[model samples]
Target: MWTAVLLACVGCYLLKLAGMSVPARVLDHPLVERVADLIPVALLAALVAVQVFAAGPGLTVDARAAGLAFAFVALLLRAPFLVVVIGAAAVAAGLRLL
Candidate 1:
């Protein structure tokens, strides 16, 4: 276990070093720029999907799904971030209580 942990740490350090060694021109390319800009959004969406739908080894659609749906509608209506989060939490909590 310690060996695996040390290897993973070394791998991560090498990956960071590789990223740092990338040339400026390569990083400045339009395609790279576009992908870099969208990576965070894509990752966040994936995380949300997993969190909302995954339950252990299977999938689920429960109060969490309803909360996500409510949040989506709130976003469409231009609700503030705090309002959206609070509204979603309230929805999931309310549903779970029933």
Candidate 2:
């Protein structure tokens, strides 16, 4: 067990060294930037959809769906984060329980 832990630590350190030592030129490509730009939008779309409609394997639409949709629109309009999360949660909980 001790040997395994030692090997794991060394392996992780080497991996980190390799990553930090990579030349800046490789990361300066426009393709890398373009992909980075698209990643956030794609991730956000996935997260929002999952939060709104996901209850299990198959998609669902319930109180959470209505609340999340409203929150999305509110966020697009520059509403504060706390306001959106709380408002959406409130609406969802209310619809679900009351």
Candidate 3:
């Protein structure tokens, strides 16, 4: 397991290094810039969806779902980031405590 972990880490580092070594002209392309700008948002949404809905390789809805809903509403309302996070945590904790 340790060997596998070390290999994976090395592979990830190499991949990152390869990306960084790509030619500046390639990275400066307009399409690449647009996609790069959007990648973080897409990744974050995917991560949130997985965390809020996945359970042991299956889908489960619970306090996290509710909290995410509240967070979504807060975002739509233009609440501050800190407020959105705190509100979501409060909602999740309140639901779990019930």
Candidate 4:
């Protein structure tokens, strides 16, 4: 497990390095610029989805999902980031307590 973790860390570092090494001309391409702009948002959404719904090898519909739903609503309502986070956590904890 430690070896796998080490390898993964090294691989991630190398991948980042490779991205940094790309020429400015390539990065300046219209398509590349668009993709770069959107990549972080896409990745964040994927990560949030996974964390909210994944349970080991299967998917779950639990308090975390409820929390995420509340968070989404809060975002749509233009709530502050701290409010969004607290609201989500409160919802999840409230649901779990019931």
Best-matching candidate per lDDT: 1
Q: Which of candidates 2 and 4 reaches a greater lDDT? A: 4
Q: Count the clashes in each prediction.
A: 0, 0, 0, 0
Candidate 2 overall lDDT versus native: 0.88
Whichever of 3 and 4 has more TM-score, that candidate is 3
Report lDDT per candidate. 1.00, 0.88, 0.99, 0.97
Q: What TM-score against the true fold does each predicted structure earn?
A: 0.98, 0.66, 0.87, 0.83
User: What TM-score would you give candidate 3 relative to the actual structure?
Assistant: 0.87
Q: Highest TM-score among the candidates is held by which one?
A: 1
- How far residue 90's Cα lies from its native spot in candidate 2, in Å, is 1.2
Q: Encode model 3's per-residue lDDT on 29-73: one tens digit a residue.
A: 999999999999999999999999999989999999999999999
Per-residue alpha-carbon lDDT of candidate 2 for residues 8-98, written as tens digits (9 for 90 to 100): 9999999999978978887688988788789999999899888788887888889988798779888999999998999889889989997
Candidate 1 residue-wise lDDT at 55: 99
Worst 10 residues of 4 by lDDT: 19-28
Better of 2 and 4 by TM-score: 4
CA deviation > 4 Å runs, candidate 2: 1-23
Model 3 segments more than 4 A misplaced: none
lDDT per residue for candidate 1 within 19-92, as digits (tens), equals: 99999999999999999999999999999999999999999999999999999999999999999999999999
**Which scores higher on lDDT, 1 or 2?**
1
Could you tell me the C-alpha RMSD of candidate 3 in Å?
1.6
After superposition, which runs of candidate 1 have C-alpha atoms over 4 Å from their true positions? none
